[model samples]
Target: MARPIWSGTLSFGLLNIPVSLMSGERRTDISFRMLDARDNTPIRYERVNADSGEEVAWKDIVKAFEYDKGSYVVLEPEDIRSAAPESHDAIEVEAFVQASQIDPRYFEKPYVLVPAKKAEKGYVLLREALSATGRIGIARVVIRTREHLCAVMPHGDALLLLMMRYPQELVDIDEYRIPEGKGADYRITAREQAFSEQLIETMSGDWDPTQYQDEFRERLQQVIRRRMKDKGVVRREDEEPELHENAATNVVDFMSLLQQSIARKRRTPAQASATGSDAPQSDGPAKKAAKKVTAKPAPKASTKAAKAAAEKAAGAASKRASRSDSSPAKPARKAVTKKRGKVA
Candidate 1:
């Protein structure tokens, strides 16, 4: 069963409609894991004190305010909860404004606001009213103990609650040095202004999200797969020499190892290392070459080979993580920094 991320009531004026918040999006990016290069074991991260390098338990970690250099004020969870704004169990609307007035840059995440059984009629009424007026409810809502300034409006037949950042969150426009056309020694001529409008019209097209994709991610995965296959080819050629020397005895053990590798792969598809004997050789088609293998890879020998493959996989994974960390978030604006308010 799908779970509600938040359960609360939508409020505007005297009317209240019980609503449950459900996430509308699920991220599907390929996730990579960290591994020890030596034995191919996964590496686990620990939250530790920076200076001491000792892992700290959750209970021992306290929220602290760094009021000044080298000074701190610790506060318990209870202290924070008490200081937070009182929860009214409602999204209190401060005003109704033209939906277009809200800049797209201010919007963050979105959730589907589903109505409760008893609140369906009221929900529909509000949805229709908002649609008719073309105005969104500018409201404050508390979700997961955090207050958000949001806009609730009809999106098609559904009500979309778009979380919004405060005005202070936007980078001060004064910081930007916009191109000047007056005293700065440049001016947009009649021809330039007319041509700019013509260019905009030439490029304008309807929004089609399906046409766009994460090409970088797709290309990176392709490279990783290609590298794995190349490593597979190298492994086969390296084993060819040993196979020819002890052709009879080595062949028997090789078959046993090959069978084990196949069975292991069926059990754990992820464990199928790229440079294993089961991998295809470059000399011929994979199916034809597999049918007439002269030698099988030794089981014991494959262990070190697995680790070698792991080292390559781990390196690729590390590079991916580094790229992911540096990639800009899809959202346009940063989280609002609260006015340097006094600590409660």
Candidate 2:
């Protein structure tokens, strides 16, 4: 099993759950080394003092912050450590918010949280609660020496801790000249909208990340292989390394909260609309078409009801035609008059 990057207690209210943090992303980008053009030798970088122009050792290196031009405030390791959160081994949740409320731009990175042995109850409880409520716990976590703003939310069978950028780190949308609501100023026509919607419907499909590949990396690798073949020496690739999941207290309270969460049904369409969780709301033809393509199947009961109503309407129309054909008055008048005229 892979070792956990950080083992810590996840705190919310009076509950504490022991958890381990692990990386959730894999990077497969090919790397290249800087080389001397003339000799094809790897280039080396040196840390040198600006004043003396002498190389510095790793042991002598210290971090510093430049406050002004040609002015720096030297900080020691201890000083940096002291500035970290008081609790290094805890993820302190401050509040819970609807996950839909978070802007996509603020999400930085994703990490998985695993419950320690025998601590699965609290972990599962939290995950289930978040999943049911469609909310995430906003928390402060100290990973290494830096404190990060993060959100703990449910992802399938696991809890995901997503690092978030601070509000200051995000550029305000108002800074850009975004077109006003629905781009009515653009004078888009209903015909254009219908065509756009049809295009989207034709192109839409379930998201499959594997379909996307790094073409540049693959092409570069092909080139390298070709060069090796030309030289009559091909290098064999090394085998890929094999890939490699808590505890809890407050049983009564946890169970109570969990049961309530489970009992609480998912948000209704009206509620979703009110909360703006049903995003990209529109009444355009394209939006309607998209819904037609993506909407869930109607309930069996609803289908039966519609069929029954159609049959009832047909039966009612047949009864009306029968009544008209056998009317008590004014039905035989034309035949009787024609017979009398023929006799005269």
Please identify model 2 stretches exceeding 4 Å from their true place.
Answer: 232-344
- Per-residue lDDT for 1-344 in model 2, tens only? 77888999999999999999999888988888999989989999999999999999999999999999989999999999999878999999999999889899989999999999999999999999988999999999998899999999998999999999999999999999976767356555565555555555655679999999899989889978887779756655788653210022423343343333333333466786676743344224556875676673555655665555555545555676556544432324444454456569
lDDT of each: 0.71, 0.78
State the lDDT of candidate 1 residue by residue for 66-185, as single tens digits: 999989999888987776679747778889999788789898988899999978899999989998999998888876667889888899889998889999999987799986556326
Predicted candidate 1, C-alpha RMSD:
27.4
Choose the strongest candidate by TM-score.
Answer: 2
Candidate 1 local Cα displacement, residue 95, angstroms: 1.1
Candidate 2: residue 138 lDDT (0-100)? 97
Predicted structure with the largest lDDT when compared to the true one: 2
Global fold similarity of model 2 (TM-score): 0.64
> Which run of 10 residues does model 2 get worst, by summed lDDT?
243-252
